[model samples]
Target chain A: MRIELALFASLEPYLPEGESASGRRTRMIDLPGGITVGEVVARLGLPDQPRVCFIDGRGVREDAVLTDGVRLAIFPPVAGG
Target chain B: MGSLLRVDMACLTVKKEPVPAGWAKYAGRALTDAIIFAEVPPKADPLGPANKLVLAPGLFGGTPAPNGGRLSIGAKSPLTGGIKESNVGGQFAHSAAKAGLAAIIIEGRPADPKALYALDIDAQGNGMLNRVDDLAGLGNYETAEKLHAMKGDDKLVTVTNGPAGEMLMKAAGIAVSDPHGYPNRFAGRGGLGAVMGSKGLKAITIPLGIESLPHADKEAFTAAVRKFANALKEHPVSGQGLPTYGTNVLANIINEAGGYPTRNFSEGRFEGVEKISGETMREITLERGGNVKHGCHTGCVIQCSRYYVHPDGSYWTKGSEYESVWALGADCGIDDMDGIAELDRKCGDLGLDTIEMGNVIAVYMESGKAEFGDVQGALAALEECAKGTETGRILGDGAEATGMAFGVERIPVVKHQAMPAYDPRPIQGIGVTYATSTQGADHTAGYSITANVLGVGGTVDPLKPLGQAELSKNLQIATAMLDSFGLCIFVAFPVLDIPAAFEAIYEMATAHTGDPWDADALMKLGRETIAFERLFNESAGFTAADDRLPAWMLTEKLPPHNSVFTVTDAELDSVHDFVAETAAEMGISKP
Candidate 1:
């Protein structure tokens, strides 16, 4: 299945050089069907915890499964007022 | 505990009083709120003789507690016309604490309308009032430079204002010196600096070479401080991400979440986000030989602050926080980091709230004074504010006055104060806070960005209304307690995720006071502080109708999400209800 992977802030280096054609800091990747967010982060060499994932801009559990064309975004914890 | 110093500007007298037995347990906002409630009249003009400005060091202030040097400034706001409290990071509060003063309360306007006095506290804590005529109308940067050279002591920390305050503009903010002697740390909301000016005050300087902050249980406090510091280092957000990128790291994430509040809140996202992003800012700072991991105050291990440098490697400004980036960059449609840095510097040096200044500039743009993204035009307008022209005076007060003066409709503000970085339409939790906060549309009052975007405290859908009121209420309660310890709120990132981190904070506070405390007790304390503020606002003529977002935000749909502030008015009214109810549930009565 084809999915869009978005890496933000400190996680950006994991993405390939330059932004993809989506006009954002995202890249398209291929993953197996029913891939959990945990497995996806692991495949991307990310920690299992302390990272938040959003599917289609909605925060989701790490165990949530991905479907085709799912936009998955991962970000390290960040804060400011 | 130390004595409270009351500086009477009317008669130019200073009196020292013991920390009242009833007020001994309270410090920071707790003590400030109690004093404001007891002394200030609800209907007093915020800039008149009846109002007072109270500065307090938190519970662990003057101690070796990490991030324990913050100071709280409280008064009736000239902008909001209600109770206001703004906190800032600097070396001032910790040194003030070491000087054996728990609080400094400024009251009454002097008979000499042109009188400008400087209050100096020497190393031995001797207080004196002097006439510093040269500092009467200088900007904060030049004033700090002159005062530092005048004092010729590395240990002195100063808090002063620019000509904006000298002119009594409502947008004026008090500037506090960082370690580098730059007056960049600001208690920059609610027009508190104007209050200082109205009192005929110029500056306050405290020498900070004290060997150690007296601690009740030095051994136990040291252990608890060590544990809290270790917990901060162990956390990913506070330790790793913030130290590297500073606060602008949220640029991309907030933009991605479709809640960045671009172009005067007319749009939810900006196309030029990358140009002003934290990643880009970090890259530029390092390439220019700048320090990215600097703390605003000493003993700040989180170090989510930075010193932005010019191309030739000279310091430009200290803060490029997410709000400043969003406010000056996308809010005005300008994307250049260098220009934003310069504008940020001008705002800091002139003692203006960058958020309010940005809002005023954006409103000016919307009025067709200048095209969006016109960097030169924005700079020209800033020059006017610095000059204190007739138009500049209107702009200096904030967006409400600017809109009124310029005949612009669709202005975005709550309680006469400009909204911060996030658009309320998409981020409804913060909308609740912006509407009901005692300080008026302040993000720090209840930073729902933690749950809304960063996923720190708890996950909440930014576009939805469900779970928003509760999220804001809990964070508001927790934040009040944190602010009292003179601790930076950045610690909340770790405390949200790690139970041990929260426990460490509780232990440290309890050890300092030598009193028992738990999560419930902490919440109760925070609730009481907020309750007093609410009571003051209520008596000052605020009603549920005043707790509302701008009318346009309810009707105008933000882009991408096509969302409005769907949080019910009833919900916005209930945002602070948890305080009283929780107090009753815990069988505690707030006087």
Candidate 2:
């Protein structure tokens, strides 16, 4: 399965090399079928920190499964207007 | 322990009276709301002589305590037709407190409606209202510059209104001087500026004084201040995330959560979210040599404010915050960052509430006056507002009026005030706050987003109705207390998670006021304050039915999650059950 992933704010540094300077990046990547969000984060070597994750604009937990064509976005903790 | 200054527009008199013994702990919103409830008649016309405008600082204002420089401006709102206390971050509060003023009350309307005057407070906090009709037509920036010159003090803070306010537009907000002497910081909600303008008051210049705020125990106060500042420095949200990206950082996260209101709330997400996200803002601002980290006033550790720049590296305006960005950009279907910044600048200069104006313009678009994403049309509508044309009047009045003029549904307002960035359908907890808040659709009144979305204090399912009422109730109580202290709302981030930080608030207040305050006393004060506001609203004819989301929000489902606002009406009413409970405890009979 293939999915689009976007990392924002401080998490942008974990994006593929040469794309981290923008402070945000979106890229398509291949993933195994029915892979959980936590496994993808670990496989991609993303930092082990508290984050807000979403699959196709719906907030999801780390254990939530992702399928093909989903757009995944992750951001570091943030609050305020 | 400063004096209260009363200025009568009808008599052109300025009187000084010692701060009431009972008002020792009252500053910011508490002081303002108390004054309004005690003095103004409940049914008084918001724009008439019977109305009064009160300006107050927090208990910590002008102190060495970090992030204590906030002002609360209150009145009977022309927009919401309810009691209003709009808070702003600026130098005016610090200067007023340093000048030995607890509050400034403006009363009566000028006999000549077209007359204008400027209220000047000297180093001794003695106020004098001087006739200054020349300032009548000036914008906020020009008004601040002119008042700054008239005062002849480099550190003088000017609070002024623009043409929108002079026109008595309900969307107008009063602008306060920032550190740079720019009238950028705003008490920017509830049509308080219209109240100010109706008084024939053009500007108020207050000098930053040399004296220090008296403390009950300077040593204890110093120690508490240190703990609070250090806690703010240590908190991730305050120390790092905010300083790095500013508040707009929430744009992507909120959009990802499907809570971001888009295209006048016809949708829940914007396709152009990335372009207007905080990450993009930081990159653009830094590339243009603009400041990505700035403070609105002194003693601010978070420094979440910023300066936006033009492509040529020249200053454009203050960086739009998350609310402004979403209100003017996504809600209006515009994605041009530069365009949004330009619109923000216009709103600031015109002394209009950017949130209110944006929502109104979106309603205008729905009426087919212009299409969504028509940046030029939106700009032209603002120009019309400045000129006070017929169409401009409709837009200037706010979202509901514009919707009525265009015969459009889905106004997205509660109590006639426009909603902020979040759509309540997907974010149910915030909806509860919006429906029941005394101030009318103000997010800061409760900010359930802290738990529902940000996971600041704790996590509550944003889409779930359970536990939302309790969450909003507790938050609203804490917020009322926070506003009374004049502490920045950002301080709540640390106070929520850091035990020392929460303890330090009461410690600092106790030492500063010598009132022997504790956490319980402060929370009771919060409850009592809210109860009075409720009483005033009830006297003004608002009933439980007024505490409800618009019919569309309850009936129509928002996209992405396809969720309707599911919080029951009973749950919404329960958020304010404290009003009656507090009244009973305080021995005040409820009407």
DockQ of each: 0.62, 0.58
Q: Model 1: how far is B248 from its true place, Å? A: 0.6
Runs in model 2 lying further than 4 Å from the true structure: A17-24
Candidate 1 is graded, for docking, as medium
How much lDDT does candidate 2 score? 0.88
C-alpha lDDT (0 to 100) for residue B392 of candidate 1: 90
TM-score, every prediction:
0.96, 0.97
Taken over the whole model, the C-alpha lDDT of each candidate is 0.85, 0.88
Residue A54, candidate 2: alpha-carbon lDDT: 81
lDDT of model number 1: 0.85
What's the true lDDT of residue A71 in model 1?
A: 86
Accuracy of chain B in candidate 1 (TM-score): 0.97
TM-score of 1: 0.96
Off by over 4 Å in 1: A1-3, A17-19, A22-24, A30-36, A63-70, B578-591
Chain A TM per prediction: 0.87, 0.85
Query: Model 2, residue B572: displacement in angstroms?
Result: 0.9
